[model samples]
Target: MAKDKIVLAYSGGLDTSIILKWLKETYDAEIIAFTADIGQKEELDGLEEKALKTGASKVYIDDLRDEFAKDFIFPMFQAATMYEGQYLLGTSIARPLIAKRMVEIARAEGAKYIAHGATGKGNDQVRFELGVAALAPEIEVIAPWRSEQFRSDFPGRAEMIAFAEKHGIPVTASAAKPYSTDRNLLHISFESGMLEDPWFDPSAEENEEMYVLSVSPERAPDQAEYVELTFEQGNCVAINGEAMSPLQVMEKLNELGGKHGIGRVDMVENRFVGMKSRGVYETPGGTILFTAHRKMESLTMDREVMHLRDSLISKYSELVYNGFWFAPERLALQALVTESQKNVSGVVRLKLYKGNVIGAGVKSPVSLYNPDIATMEADPSQAYDQGDATGFIRLNALRLKVSAGVNQSK
Candidate 1:
């Protein structure tokens, strides 16, 4: 009888490297390793050779950077999704894409079970499993961290390292670090291990070296740098007057923002699994784009439409954070968000300083700002009548007057 095949999301890392071999041995099945290249930088080097040598029957390294930036990152940016008003949903957004691809590979490989290295404690477990269930309901998910047998066999990183050596797995001695990091085109997030303590500052002089994307604010250049962003229907299409694709725009912003030491965030946040986790993130490109996008909206978006969309920010962000990216509610909300951006086309100039994105100027062809109506000086056009405010104020004051009378009677 032929053995069942399991498709595993492999990341050429210690946990995934061990999981790949363990899955094959425990299940007595063939393991097909799948790695998604979403701008991990140099992490992709030797990934295929490493996976095959470890135990994977076949290896796949799909470059999903363009799809990730244009599809996932851009749409979320349209909604201005920031979990808790700070997080750019960087790590939160990438999980669905990875899970989506894993499902595709599982179906293509005729694999009944799909596995992942996401642990039982973190949000990735929920994200990976929920994404798979939403896409392929019939596919079985194998979470080794939740398995007692797997947990007992490898109690900690030390035991895993031992097993890796015994099984001829490749892992450097420095693999066991003080914290863990997840990276993609949008951002890089650091948490867990030393970051579990909310009081521990990752930006301290001693610990600041851990940051990978930007320099400390104190170390940034004395002079501020100016950048210009051009947007079309809420999507950034160019930087500094140069037209480029979504991926290219992100790359340019990341470069400039990183040079200016921008987009570093440290906070204690509520996780979906009923826990408060401390996370430090570096989102250079995302920060620049978000600021410029909102500035553009101020010029072109309607007041009521922008307000209604703003009201959904919390709910929309929560949905994405809690692994509901594929849910019907998110889809419906996305449609409304997409419609709201129809006129959000404009140009915004920004000043990037030490850890700051300040607005320089904003202009739009569809600008709702009319100098004739808004000018304080006498306007011959009389587009807005100053005398019209009397009746409008009196009518609006009626409710307050009635409430005052009622309160006096009480």
Candidate 2:
């Protein structure tokens, strides 16, 4: 009889390498390794050779960069999604895409078992498993990090390194440089290791060594640089008069934004697992896109409609952060977001200096802003609504006035 087959979401990183070996030893099964390329840059170097050398029966390295940007990143940006009002949700959003692809590969390869290296205490474990459940519920997920057998065998990175050593799997990381990072076209995220301390500031050396997408804010150029972006129906369509595809747009903006040291964020964010974690992120292109998208909306979106959409931002972002990208409620929320952006078509000029994304100007043919109504100069009687303020203020203040009178009488 043929042995069981398992599909592993392999990064060729130390953790996945160890898991790949452990699964083979434990299950005595055939292992097919799959790696998704969502623009992880140098991290993907030699990944195929590493996986095959490390005992993967078959290996797949697929490029999901364009799909990641257009399908996942753009929709989230259209909603102005942010977790805890600070984090750009870079890592959180990538998990679903990875898991979705893994499930598809599992089906194609006739594998019923899907495995990942996400730890129990983390949101990624939840994100990965939830994505699998949503898409391919029939596929069994093996989360080795959460299993008692694996955790007891290898408690930390040191044990993991030892396991790889015994198994003859090569690993480059060590105690000397001790942080975990995840990268994609949108951003690069650094977490864990020495970053666990809430007050710890990364040294200049660490920043320079680890940063791949952007430069340090202090080292950025003195002069500000400007770029213009065009949007139609809430999606960015062009940059600086050059119409480009979604992936091309991100690549160009990332180059420009990185040069100016834009889109660096450091914060202690609340995880969906109910723990706070410190992370440093560089989201050059995403920052430019988010700032420009909002600026365009300020010109074309209706005032109350914008406010209403803004009201739903926190909840929508929560759903995303909590790994609900494929959930029904999130789909409903996205539908509403789509409806609100019907007329959000415009060009927004942005000035990038250091880490700041400043909106310089915005224009749209469908702009609701009337120059005559908003001018500081004198207004005609027909345009003058100055007298309307008295009744408006009185009506709003009536409850306060009544409360004050009641207090005096008492």
Candidate 3:
């Protein structure tokens, strides 16, 4: 009889590396490690060899960078979605895409079970599971971190390190650096370890190695550089007048923004599991995209329409953060968001300085900014009558005046 196969979303990290060995030993199942290459440059180095050495039957690394930026990142960018008004949805948006690909690989490999290294405490577990539920409901999810047997066998990181040492699984963990990090093309996230202390300032000495995309702002370029972004129906299509693909546009922005130290966010956000966690992120490309998009919207979008869409951005962001990418409510909200961008076509020029995205200028074919009506230099003949303001003011103030009169009488 053939043993059942389990497809693990392997990052070749400490947790997943240990989990691969444990799954093989404990379940007596074939382990196929699947790694998503979503722009983590060196992180993918020797991952396949590492996974196989760590007891994986086979290893598959899929480059989902272009698809990730074009399909997933751009759509969310169109909505200008930000979780908790700060998080750029870096890790949140990537989870569903990874989960979708994991299910695809599982089906192809004839695997009945899929596993992930997402911890029980984080929002990622919910995101990964919910994505699998939506995409491939038939495939059973085997989350070892949330399992009693696995947790009992390897209680913590220390125990896992010991197991790795005993089993000859080469790991990079040591006493000096203990923080956990997640990195992709869009951003690099750092949390846990020394960051567990809410009051702890991320010291330069301790956290200097965490930066993947950019150097410190103090070391950034002294002179500001201007970049023009062209958008059509809310999708960024060109950079500095050169037509480029979505992926290329982001790549260009990442280069420009990183040099200027434009996108670094350190915040303690409320997780989906109701715990506050500190995450330091570097989202260079995404920062430029958001700033440029907003500038374009200011020139082209109607005031009421912009306000209405802004009201729903929090809900849209929350849905994505909470792993409801495939949910009906999210789809419905996306429809509104997409429709709101129908005329959001324009060019926005921005000045990038050390950690600053300053809006230089914006222009659009759909611009509602009429200089004739807005400029003080407009002809008096074209203006409205000043005498009509008397009745307009009086009528508008009547309720307030009446309330004041009643209050005074009382």
Candidate 3: misplaced stretches above 4 Å?
203-206, 380-395, 402-410
lDDT of 1 by residue, 2-78 (tens): 89999999988778998998898899999999999998888789989999999999999999999999999999999
Q: Which stretches of candidate 1 lie over 4 Å from their true place?
A: 165-168, 172-176
Please report the TM-score between candidate 2 and the true structure.
0.96
Candidate 2 whole-model C-alpha lDDT, 0 to 1: 0.88
TM-score of each: 0.97, 0.96, 0.95
Question: lDDT tens digits, residues 253-331, model 3?
Answer: 8888889887888899999999888988888999999989998998888899899999989998999999999899988
Cα lDDT tens digits, model 2, 1-410, are 88888999898777899999889889898899999999887888998898888878999999999999899998889898877877888888999999999999999999989999888888888899899999998999999988899999998998888788887898765776667788888898888788888677763655477777888888889999989999999999999999988889889989998998888888998888888888999889998999899889988888898899999999999887888889999999999999999999989999999878998999998998888788877775357678998999999999999999999999
List candidate 2 segments past 4 Å from native: 203-207
- Which candidate ranks first by lDDT, i.e. highest? 1
The global C-alpha lDDT for each of the candidates, from Candidate 1 onward, is 0.90, 0.88, 0.88
